[model samples]
Target: MADAPLKVDFISGAVDYRRRQGGGRGQALPKALGFRKGVTPDVVDATAGLGRDAFLLASLRARVTLIERNETMHRLLAEAMARAAAESPLHGEIIARMTLILGDAREILPSLKPETVLIDPMHPPRGKSALVKAEMRQLRDLVGSDPDCAELMRVALACTSKRVVLKWPRRAALLPGLPAPSHQIVGKSTRYDVFMKLPAPAGHS
Candidate 1:
């Protein structure tokens, strides 16, 4: 039998993240995801850990699909979205734009026909000087490292039409087996590596 799911306050966490928008690291992510003033791309957050980043994107009015394969995490995310939709004033709208899927991205990405795929795989802890947040520490405890992240990237590249974005520590090594990013958005502690899809062959499209 499986253990009971862990509980988390994702609604409150998302609220706090929203309150911090337009300031510090918060401002960098949306731009990295290709968000513009009046355009909201459809996004698939392939590794929706606790749904924080996914919520951020939806709060900016982007339609987001959150995919989490862990049953415990999936339950927690579902509850958080439900509570936010019911309690948080803007979250109703936010949750409306967000969808949840309980499955692996490798098996799921092809069917979604994603325009953008966002990957933030679990990585090793940085040097002792860099403190991992409580939420992130808890996530690492639950999910361990994402060993197949390279495969996830490969699957995302094949399915996504516009671009695939990867969030990694600024100083961390790029995922093995992936090519260099076309461009990058660097922040103080993290960076978003973007890979744009090739245009379809004229005869094929």
Candidate 2:
């Protein structure tokens, strides 16, 4: 028999636990996209799968906009955010900083001029036999493979004013036929490839 479907919850589950234990801006994600030039700029989560990363950004006080193209996933994310909002004052505040939009990020990103555009598009599997994490497996099953990651990367680079952050596998090759990131933040298993949109001109010595 097929294993029972994973429970997709944002509150009072593993997701909640992780958020509560987070290390603020010290974590890789926040560092990759937050505290840039001393600014905790607002973010557009262009591929907001499950919304955990976006929630982390919101908790650290950056306004986050989550865009999910899948109808069912968007509905679930909206419901979870609503539930979190109605829970208490603190949770409500985080939810307040978050806005959920149901649409294609490529189509929607150009309309808004955010300080940063974060693209955490799906990654290809790790290996043949290595077990896929349950959460990621569920996401892959739902959204299928990401054929347009390169295109999305191009779009994000064009849209955001300050920077564009791509959440990618640590060892995976950089997206082909795209401009490389300014630099990367390498964690144990994930990498944040940050592309600066408008880098400052260097000063003369």
The per-residue C-alpha lDDT of model 2 at residue 113 equals 71
Candidate 1 structure quality by residue, lDDT tens digits, 38-142: 667889999998787887778777889999999889889898889878976776888999899999999999999999999999976877824776666678888
Worst 10 residues of 2 by lDDT: 1-10
- Candidate 2: stretches off by over 4 Å: 36-38, 128-130, 199-205
Clashes of each: 0, 0
Candidate 1 clashes between residue pairs 3 or more apart in a chain or in different chains? none
Instruction: Give me the displacement of residue 163 in model 1, in angstroms.
Output: 0.2
lDDT of 2 by residue, 1-205 (tens): 4656644566687667877897477788888885645678889999988898888788778899999998888988988898889988888998899999999888988898777888998887777534777767777889877799899888888777888999998999999998888999999989999998765579832
Candidate 1 root-mean-square deviation in Å: 3.7
- For each candidate, give its TM-score against the true structure: 0.89, 0.91
Q: Residue 60 of candidate 2: its Cα lDDT?
A: 79
- Model 1 misplaced stretches (Cα beyond 4 Å): 1-7, 13-15, 23-26
